[model samples]
Target: MTRTSLRGVIAAIVTPATPGLDPDAPRFLRHARQLLAEGADGLNVLGTTGEATSFSLDQRRGLMEAAAAGLPRDRLMVGTGAAATRDAVELTRHAGDCGFAGALVLPPFYYKGVGTEGILRYFDAIAEGSAASGIPLYLYNFPALSGVPYTEDLVSALVARFGGRIAGLKDSSGDIGYARRIAALPGGLDVFPSSEAVLDQARAGGPFAGCISATVNVSARHAAAALHGGDDAALQRATAIRALFDGKPLVPWLKQAVAARMGDPGYGPVLPPFVPPDPAAVATLVTELEKIDKAPARP
Candidate 1:
């Protein structure tokens, strides 16, 4: 089987919420369409940016279904990773049933001390069960959150074992060295650096197929332009804009930034266990993001 190539800028889109925190279908569709219109090559729905862990299983299904309905299947990648293997398998099947191009599966993270052999087994199980589902599976390596890093050796073994079934990886560890190391692996596996800064190197012939960026929620146009044009100036601008939200707690800061852009006053509520950013922080983020928005595009 031929390797699946996922190139270009894919946006890790945010999930829109109504006053009571229910999934705002209309707003979610609007966001997806806006990202696609703004030059995003594909949509990564229900990702970290979309607060997938905060949502229940049914809610996740709803979001993926809505995204699949609103966007072209060829341009949509849905996160089907869950703490539970059964849930991951079920959700992945659902994503395929809904016509998503692929499912990004996080390793079984709830169990710590999961060795490389253990991780491989977990992925193998998913691949075996998902044979008929037909959704390509991409490993999600966000060690900071998952507590299970996809080491180079482990990644190689999985690729060799699963071949084309293990489509690619979204390396959100925020380490360029890790990203480059994974990209350097043989077999032409697709490696996606989770930031815009690496786009230049990726474009310069690294093994990276593209980027899956959370910042693209606000800077999709610039990110997409940088990826395709290979413009250093454009990439620098994207890096700077992303730097604004670098330190802020992601969920609240991202929602605040999105709300500020939309002029929505009530977009500050994050689901429980994760509070919204304080008003002062929101004000500061707004200021910072506004500066980025108004900054001149590099010539």
Candidate 2:
């Protein structure tokens, strides 16, 4: 059956933690609200950028419930994948119960060399477990970090088997060609390339639904203008700002930027196994961002 999927600029926001390093619900809600106020069509909380895996399942769920309570649930999707099948199922069900628009699920990454069939079975459980709630699942393909790429064939197979339950995908593979091909797949899947660089193409009638991007946290205003209004200058500025993060530690650098923008160091704490970004690097990013922000919009 055909179904409408989430489209437009969705920001994968950074999670703010308290000094004790727990997911700060009030701070998280504030950031989520801020993103929507700044022109983000939706928010993808607890994704890789939001440090989902770094937080405990309870922490993730508490934050999810808090977000759903405070924000428009239809405008929020949360990362629900885990290396463990049961945990993935639990989180996916919780997300559905919380009334989220969708769950962005990564492949079971702890296992290497698990072929498509193995991964398929893993998702089969997730699909069945959350079937009662009917929450859609957006396959997250971030091979570099997850090391478990969702091949096109696998995606097609899942869609065939699960239909609307397999709503769409977030292709962080950074391969626009692959994302385009996935968007071309049957069953009305909403394929979101993980960068605002493609906003112009999408507005040009490209197949992509829109973008699910970490950098959109800072670039949402420009992205929304570009995607919804066909503003090329806005698109360029958004992409230029996004490019500034290249080669830096993505999560920390983004947190640093958010902390600076909000003037609250509480946004500065990243979960362990990750540390704060270098001050010099953050300064350089801020400087370049200022230049892009000040550049005149093309007439």
Candidate 3:
């Protein structure tokens, strides 16, 4: 099988929503263009940063379609994972049909205590169902949200079983040790760290293909430079920017920054169960982020 490379910065883009709580397709298209122009090599839409779980099936499909219409297929990877096997398969198939480069598959996450066999079976079923079209699959190993970690053994088995169909793994574990272990695997699977803090190490040949950071939605150019430069100063600046969202709700804080940059007041409102930050919190965060933004990028 020919080896597939996933080297470069891939932004986990936020799906912009209008004041009416509908996804703002035009805004998303503009964001995609901006990210590409700012030096992002690829876009990962519908991931956690995109509030994927909150979206209805129709909404998710619409987002994917809009992205496909706006960006080149090779530059887009849509998150298609769902708690249900059929839903994941259907979404993955849809991504392929819409011409996305690949589908980022989260393990079946709803059922806690699910055995490794169960998780493997879920992916196997989706892969088998998607076999005819040969849609590329990237494993999204975010144990924090999914509560199901993708162990090395499991990844190895899946890669061996899926062969060229399994494209890579996106490790959001936030544990550099685990990321290093995944990178050390023999097949040269594309390993993406979820945080920009590891870019220096990753750039120094640590097996990290690139980053798919939530913060990159707003700071794509800075994140891209950090990945390419691989210097401590660059990583520190990126980390400091991410630090702004540390104590607050990540999504809301991110939305606030994005809104401030784009001058869209509607961007601050999150969907149900994720209320916007209190006014005081938003004020403080805005001030802090403004300072960070104005600071020079490290040499």
Candidate 4:
């Protein structure tokens, strides 16, 4: 299977859960299709927003397989990062087998202070194991949650050693400067900053490949408009929607908004370690989002 460079507004989509919480495939596909139709250039399945780490290897693979079979393969990038090297390799290989465009991988998060060498070795194993599959690997750099930041030297080292196999990096650190430095690297690595706010820069043919955002789940239309058309109004609206989740639990808020909009309450329950947002809060969020959607563009 051939892979292409994934760019534009990629939604870090939410996974719909069954009563058993085992990934409702039908609901999952429906949501995915809707997001693409709504203007997401691609879907990042099982990423942070999708609660990837909460699910088992089998569960992740199952959802991936279902998505590949149902959705357009070239537009899907699945999160295959695991605390275990073997598990990460397996999930990544399965992603390649399912014909996903790329695998978004996080560094080993369970052990803190392993240093860059340890992280390099972890990615080395992933590259060596999944080499036969030939799936491009996009490094996921969310240091706050993982406690292991991929420093500049570490990123350069990985790119130098792995070359094109090390495809890109997603900087959810919310630091655009760091992301820009990675994007300016000698190699043609696609650096995706994790915010819709950068869409204008990306649309202007700047260093950023595009954005990989959780909020794109709700604001795909505005994101696409901003990214492709230089629509400042749309950009402002997308940024506003994202800002509303500040300091609150993001997953629950996203899930609640998705459930309320999609009219599927199954999307409401989050995996443990994340409690559902208050109904009042969700109502307020939905109301504000509606206003953003309806409000006229700035004069």
Q: Model 2 segments beyond 4 Å from truth? A: none
The sequence of per-residue lDDT tens digits that candidate 1 reaches over residues 1-299 is 45553568888888877777777778778777888898898888888888888889998888788877877888888898888888888888888889888889898889988888888777766776677867888889999999988889988999888877777889998887887787778766678888888777667566678899988888887787787887667777788888988777887788788878767755556776777778887788788877776777665
lDDT of 3 by residue, 1-299 (tens): 45443457788888888777778898888878988898788888999988898888889999898888878888888899999899998899889889888889999888888776787789888987777768889999999999988999888888887777888889988888898888788676788888777676667656787788888876677777777855556566678888878767788778878887778776667887788877877878778877776777553
Model 3 segments beyond 4 Å from truth?
1-5, 230-232, 297-299
Model 2 earns a TM-score of 0.97
- List of clashing residue pairs for candidate 2: none
Model 1 has a clash total of 0
lDDT of 4 by residue, 8-81 (tens): 99999999888787988898899899999988999999999999999888999999999999999999999999
lDDT of 4: 0.90
Q: Would you estimate the TM-scores of all the predictions? A: 0.94, 0.97, 0.94, 0.97
Weakest ten-residue segment in model 4 by summed lDDT: 1-10
lDDT of 4 at 253: 93
Cα lDDT of model 2 by residue, 1-299, tens digit: 54544778999999999889899988888878888998999999899999999999999999998999999988988999999999999999999999998999999999888987898899889989999889989999999999988898999988888888888899999898898899888886888999999887777677888899999878888999999998989999999999999888899988888887777878888899998877887888888887887798888
C-alpha lDDT score of every prediction, in listed order = 0.81, 0.89, 0.81, 0.90
